[model samples]
Target chain A: MSLEIEVFATLNGIPDEAINNKTVIVIDVLRATTTITVALAAGCLEVIPVLTPEEAIEMRERLGDERVLLGGERNALKIPGFDLGNSPLEYTTEIVAGKRLIITTTNGTRAIRRAAGGRLVFLGAMINAPAVAGLAATAATDITIICAGTRDRFSLEDFLTAGLLVDQLAGQGEFVLRDGALAARDYYYCHRADPAAALKASFHGRLLADLGMEADVEFCSRVGATDVVPVYGGGIIKKAS
Target chain B: MSLEIEVFATLNGIPDEAINNKTVIVIDVLRATTTITVALAAGCLEVIPVLTPEEAIEMRERLGDERVLLGGERNALKIPGFDLGNSPLEYTTEIVAGKRLIITTTNGTRAIRRAAGGRLVFLGAMINAPAVAGLAATAATDITIICAGTRDRFSLEDFLTAGLLVDQLAGQGEFVLRDGALAARDYYYCHRADPAAALKASFHGRLLADLGMEADVEFCSRVGATDVVPVYGGGIIKKAS
Candidate 1:
């Protein structure tokens, strides 16, 4: 039998088979995925995802500070001594051009590290979701979408973004939707009327608002603004080749 | 912040929050949930879900067989000396009428036992998707959907059914879909066009076919055939009053 695609809402929800020998698409739409997608689209060379802050520091040391820039966030705050934070706004072309960024984050990067074996792609609101789904549709292996929710809990922004992506994929021929995919699509449908409002209402969004980052939430919710799909391969994420 | 409703593709994936103070809907469309729904809908008085066949036998002794019936399955076969298997077909009106069933199955029943704390509702393809969603939507507590996947792995059938159910709950206001919920919904959309073919292509379906039970696969795919929503309360499932 051919491989069947499966969608998992969280890393914890992913089954052994969904991870084993499968192509996984990881989404952290509130910030990380969106940030990375924008950074790459804005002409960043590559992003090396590190599991721990210490690892990012070590990578920066090995790669040399002249060529490598440090980028990460802990609890959505910029790490001390880092060149940039986890916001897409901070990853503009003027700063990230021709730079290799060593990045770490609380949830999204950890998920990327855990997903070392699978064929991993990073999706954001900027990318045309249909393009990402099209890439998944052509892959011979089973597809697993892992949403990097906030701190071991479900994040609404990520779920809705994943749903929008899944909704696009479901429109393709002969594809079967699983419960996780259906949940994502339905969630997208539920929030499709007002994505900015949905993002603002999220737990992370409220935290960001408390931290005075309401503009970032609005920016992240704007869909299809960019057409870049950053696929994670080797040890870094680059614009999908 | 209000408690968010998180769904899990399997019992093992349930977060502490979703496992506690939540009204969990456990679904095993390949049969446990479907069979229980069919059994109770067919007129069975009550269904006691136990973790093991041994536990089921012990309860049978205490409850007495005057009205109780031992029911279970292992590897899709009837447990030795049990009155019924995990087959919706066996739960016909004539056989299950007014009887009490003690069930312990491989995947579905075990998931129900592990999901002990919540107000558990057993769901199957038989129930109307809207009704399952309505119960979750109107519940006083947060909702968790525990899909009884095959042997702790992601089973397409259970997840697709969960997606169908979760889709109904979306857009009810003041609700957020978790990663598990998103994934299930994505799965549902992917499979909605041709559910039977989707079921036939699942890992469990292939195994069932190897065992020469392809009929069971087709039988389980029929939606909304039963209206019963078997609520697991007081450690037993009965038609919710």
Candidate 2:
């Protein structure tokens, strides 16, 4: 039998047992996972995802201010003392190269922490969809795609990003897409021709645009913008070799 | 501002607060809500929804088995000794007319009970999409559609049924679709031309086929097969007139 690929519309929607032995692919396309992929691809040494702003601050203190940069957002804006906000375009090689970054956000980081029990956890977004799907195509265990929706609710951006990955992995012809994945695959095919239009239709996409962050939406909507798949292990995310 | 209409992929995926003071629509296309709509359209008195098989038995005894029928399924098969299974075709006018039904299912009935917090709880299926959407169009509060997914996991059959409702409610031009609703509307439109094919694409639809219940699938997939909207309140579901 082929591997099973399932998509969850939100982090809270997933059962604990689904992650225990599966290869988990996490998507937060509006920004968190997208930003992580951009930061790692821009040459950041590694990113440590923290759940709260206070934890991000503490990580900065413990890792020493010289090499660790704080990057995150609260309500889609930069934290008061953080070096960067949660925009993928903000993480250029000039700023992030060779640095250890600590990040936190409203939804994405919490999902990463929740997937810690998985046999393997890889952060995915539109920018890194095919690379992440390639990882799934080679996994020994079944794959679970978890969308890090905004504030315990569904986010279309993450869901479509999950769909894009599903489309890619299913291309290997060794997958049995399950319920959510089954739905997502069809949605992906419907919107594949114009993904940016799909992203602009998302609630978070409009939320970001309302906050004058359309550039972030524009940046995150590009498929295969980079080939970096950030794998999470031992409490940190780094571009897979 | 357009009235907000949100779609939840599963009963458990929704937070308790999402249903309060809202108009909630529950769906189980394969085939709890479908069966309920069929039974009511065939002139059944009312459906008493219970959470457990034991509660169904208790209800049958308390209501006096002489006039009451036990109708439910566990794992898609008729519960042993029950009068009917969770199939739309079984509740013919000859069998269900003028009788009270105590019904339970693996997903749908529980979803109806869980939506008790809503200002109004209505059961939906492809069989009653237009009528249920008419109810939402006139609802006093924002709407929440809970898909009675299979065993806490997302089910496309319920989801596409939800999308159908979303499409119809949005047709009135006063509803603002939220994240899940936005995604659902797209999926619904994609499959609207041929809804039967869409149901056949669902995980549960194939499961029913595997179990020799293709007749139920055929029955449930017909859009607007009946216009009866079953509203659940105070522990019983009845035709909304």
- Enumerate the candidates' DockQ scores in order: 0.18, 0.69
| lDDT for position A53 in model 1 | 85
For candidate 2, write residues B1-241 as lDDT tens digits: 6679999887765787789988999998899999999999999999999989999998777777586999999989999989898888889999999999999898888888889999889999988999898987897678999998888688988889899999998887577789999898888878888989878878888989999988889889888877799998898899997
Query: Worst lDDT window (10 residues) for model 2 chain B?
Result: B58-67
lDDT of 1 by residue, B1-241 (tens): 5545555655664656666677788878787887888888889999989989999889989976787888878988899989988877788888989899999889888788767787555454535456666666788677777777766455667777877877767756476665556656655776688778877877777777898778888888877665677788778788876
Model 2 Cα shift for residue A155 (angstroms): 1.0
Instruction: Determine the iRMS, in angstroms, of model 1.
Output: 5.3
Residue A72, candidate 2: C-alpha displacement in angstroms: 1.0
Q: What interface RMSD does each of the candidate structures achieve?
A: 5.3, 1.4
Segments of candidate 1 deviating more than 4 angstroms = A1-4, A58-64, A119-140, A154-156, A163-214, A221-229, A239-241, B1-6, B41-45, B52-68, B73-81, B119-139, B149-235, B238-241
Which candidate has the highest TM-score of all?
A: 2
For candidate 1, give the docking quality class from DockQ. incorrect
Q: Write the per-residue lDDT of candidate 1 for residues A4-105, one digit (tens) a residue.
A: 545565566455567766778888877888888888888899998888888899888887668788888998899998889998899988999888888888
Candidate 2 wrong stretches, greater than 4 Å = none
Q: After TM-score superposition, what is the CA distance of residue A53 in candidate 1 from its true location, in Å?
A: 3.3
